[model samples]
Target: MDLKNLHVLQQLMDLSQDCFLVPGPVRMGQPCLNALSTPVMTARGPEFRDVMAHLNSGLRNAFNLAPSEPVRGVQSWSGDDDYKVVVVSGSGTAAMEMVIANRFRSNDLVLVPTNGKFGERVAEMCQRFCNVKHLKYEWGRAFDLYELERQLERGCYESLLICHNETSTGITQDAAAIAEMCARHNTSFILDGITSVGGMPVHPTEWKAEAVVVGAQKCTAGPSGIAAIAINSNFIERVHAIRDQGDSNPNYYLDLVAALKKGGDDQTPWTPAINLAMGWGAALDVLKNESNKVRWDRCETMANGVRNLFLDLGFELLADAEQRSSTVTSILYPEGIDDAWRARLKEEFNTQVIGAQDHLKGKMFRIGSMGETPISEMVEGCKRMIECFTQFGMELPKVDVESYFK
Candidate 1:
């Protein structure tokens, strides 16, 4: 087998032609692509330190944290001291697990509300280190805040973990309301902002989220294999107290304290994917150039455009209308259509979209509105979907696609 020249590789390369609509590992812009190709530099060298500085600042800005000014020689990075932002050489899940590992202990009680795959994952992670109480909902349904409050009113919870955006279901949680609940109860707020941070409104401090995790591959349109966290002083102080009691975090590489200490100096605790950091920093630059508000609005516009396009085609959406996310849109497949439609869309039209996860597989497909994916591309993707559906004996109603985006 000539593995190096596999046809599948060519098929992936063909993606450059146009149309990438998956929920994550989104289409990268030229700037990030150029940054990824830069010659690998020594991770511990001064130049990489500067790279880290820029990356840290970018991540902070995306999280809506106050800007920090670097004080020259003593500490290369010193802004936002109240919040420690750490970048790790792993995916968003690794960052989420790091939070659970460092902050929760066997004796702690945690409340996790699950309505999607990522929400279920947070509960699973918490179960490893703490007593987890799940306010579970059926997939595709929004969480019941009244029920959550009822649970919280019972007291004794040390932390609350939730996903800001449930990518798997294309539902954005009500962070503002949840934040108020967490504050009232005095529970540490941990958020999974993987698909939300850069694409939508994710103000960790404003939401009172003590710990938040973000993925580079999602909203930022950067390469995968890197994730970041934004956490406040309260989280750090609690972790220190836990360490002082001799119950240090089990995983060394993800040890929060060491990571935060090194991060303060614009460095990682271990060898990092330096190229990925450079790429992510470049992608974050694109985010900053547009400004957070405008970027967020664009995402909303894209999401609205995608949703309206699908709905006009007679497709039912998976998420509740009001809770639908600005980053992804999950659409239920029309009767007699299945996952095979996605392949035909890609094979015949050079368009790609994501399939459902878990039990929803084959029953639904998702279209991502995040990153550098152009609205025109998504509109084209929808057109391909229409063509594909027609071949399946389903003729969608004609719609003025331009009106959808507006």
Candidate 2:
């Protein structure tokens, strides 16, 4: 074998290597329809110059804060003035890691309530960086607050981490109740509000969250590169004391204290995604201008429409009707149907729906109504889904999908 072109080149030429870049099924924002695509129009010439001159001012104005504020105005308020917010390269994962590495000591026990994929990820994140004690819940199932409080009273944990909206299973936990429980136990509360910040109701300050994290991709209607974590003054002081004592923070890029000191005008610890920041600025402006109640009601109405359609189609929902997330819904697949039926639905109808993850995969599929989806479009998607089910030999009752729009 000519080693230069034999072993190495053979491996490089393998067919399996090419599979990585192959396009998967179309996603929510990147629907097949060109008209519905998320507009990423960049500023040009004078518009670009004007945006550049006043971008910082725009960000400050959006949050009703000063330009020199230590915290990034994009983050939700976490009930403290001293704490600083920092933007990171990764999404919610970056926010989680930053908080975990900065806040926890070697032996500090943290409580994680796992109800879905994101909640499980929170546990995994904690396990890697801190001593974790999981307070597990079944997927699609909401935890009882009384039981959670009792567990926290008995457990030796410094912080309790939860995913406010478990997008994986379409269940939204009560962050305020969870935070109150943590408060009673004198434990710090960390909430992953990645999917709930804008579309869903989440007031970190009122919820008693000591630290909160959100990503731009979900409810913010922004690009994915930017993430923010808001911390309480007490939490910041604790992290600052740890840093001052020469304790090594594991990740360099997500060091919030350092990022805050540098100010948002300067580059991030790494090169910032300038384009994403621009999109995020625009999206945040839209969110601020739009009434919160109106946006929330729209999501609620869409979710309910989907749920009603599922009922008419003779399918069971994974979560209780009241507890289901307004942003997404996970409905059980028809009994005795094979995966091929799902494939046919996608290929023939030009509609994209998500199958469940892990144990729930093949058992259920998730339908989401978020991020600029018109009510009429959602109704059409549901009607198509029903038709697909009928084509697969599962007879579905006709639904007044049009009435759902009203």
Candidate 3:
């Protein structure tokens, strides 16, 4: 319980190095970086605890729920009574697993439309739990909604899975359009918004999404660990009806009904990541402020800044500007440079940038402006990157950092 011992602190500090940039050349201009320096307490803060206490009282007063709701910080349904939200361990993957395990029996037909790495992971996860009918697409190409509709009309699936933002390739699907089509077809819809939520406009309730899964790290500006799902009442009822027929729930940890019945109070079936949750709570408080719109617009503005920087530097983006994700920007590495040179840039520059997944690995590198990353850091990161390119024997344009950052 004493998490402050020197050895423990050292380990935590080491982990923080990997999780955050501290007074380094890459620090983001956000208060979150400061929060990381403090000792993480196990319990909630006084203000957060008071809010939970009031929510607990409200739940009890309205729903007649037991004290269990307080433990998990579950609040009463104030907006729409037709849906339930559940928090879980892993990131968005956990929420997605919960929906896949609970909604369908083993070998039940489902449509999985994959465009990138996360989309492929969704299909893989679905296959692990059910018989998935994968509708695969090229990594950077847009999915054909008409083809999706045609496949659905062929009567082969009971559910459809879509990833709103394919982080691997900077492609965002038309989720609202897909949700509308699924609604018309009476097919269950599950959307993976791991990198889309909070950074972009996503209203799960209004979009008629059966299940919307989100992670804390990407758009929420939170530490990784906590993942959440918003489930409509109809989906909950469907799970109940399936269980009533004596089918086994494929996954116990991801069982939404059992989690909700705990009144949102108990610890997860598995031990929870407490410190990460604390960080997430702090991040969410920042997100709920009225200036959240400005924060999102800042992401858009920063993304545009990055895109324009790359284009001005004579490097092409991997995806179209309109379809690219506001959170991460993928750029095709300039021609004539091989993978070995790309690896050298990171070794020399002391900057971390992600390369493409699978076949696109040698062709592209991705830079993210997610969380509290400052636009200045990105502008400088690009300059260092260009310097590295020049050092690697690649011909590069002369970038005036003074004018660039201005």
The number of the candidate with the highest lDDT is 1
RMSD of each: 4.7, 10.3, 8.7
Q: Please list the residue runs of candidate 3 whose C-alpha ends up more than 4 Å from where it truly belongs after superposition.
A: 1-78, 264-270, 338-347, 398-406
Alpha carbon lDDT at 229, candidate 3: 70
Superposition TM-score, candidate 1 onto the true structure: 0.93
lDDT of 2 by residue, 313-366 (tens): 678899866688888888887778755656755655556777778888788877
Question: For each candidate, what is the lDDT?
Answer: 0.85, 0.66, 0.66
Candidate 1 lDDT for residue 162: 94
Task: Show where candidate 1 strays beyond 4 Å.
Answer: 1-16, 69-81
Estimate TM-scores for all models.
0.93, 0.80, 0.79
CA displacement after TM-score superposition, residue 374 of candidate 3 (Å):
1.6
The collision pairs in model 2 are none
- In model 2, which regions exceed 4 Å deviation? 1-84, 264-267
Model 3: lDDT equals 0.66
lDDT (10s digit) by residue, model 3, range 276-350: 545555565565552446656766776777777778888888775568777777889777765665565454444
By TM-score rank, best first, the candidates go 1, 2, 3
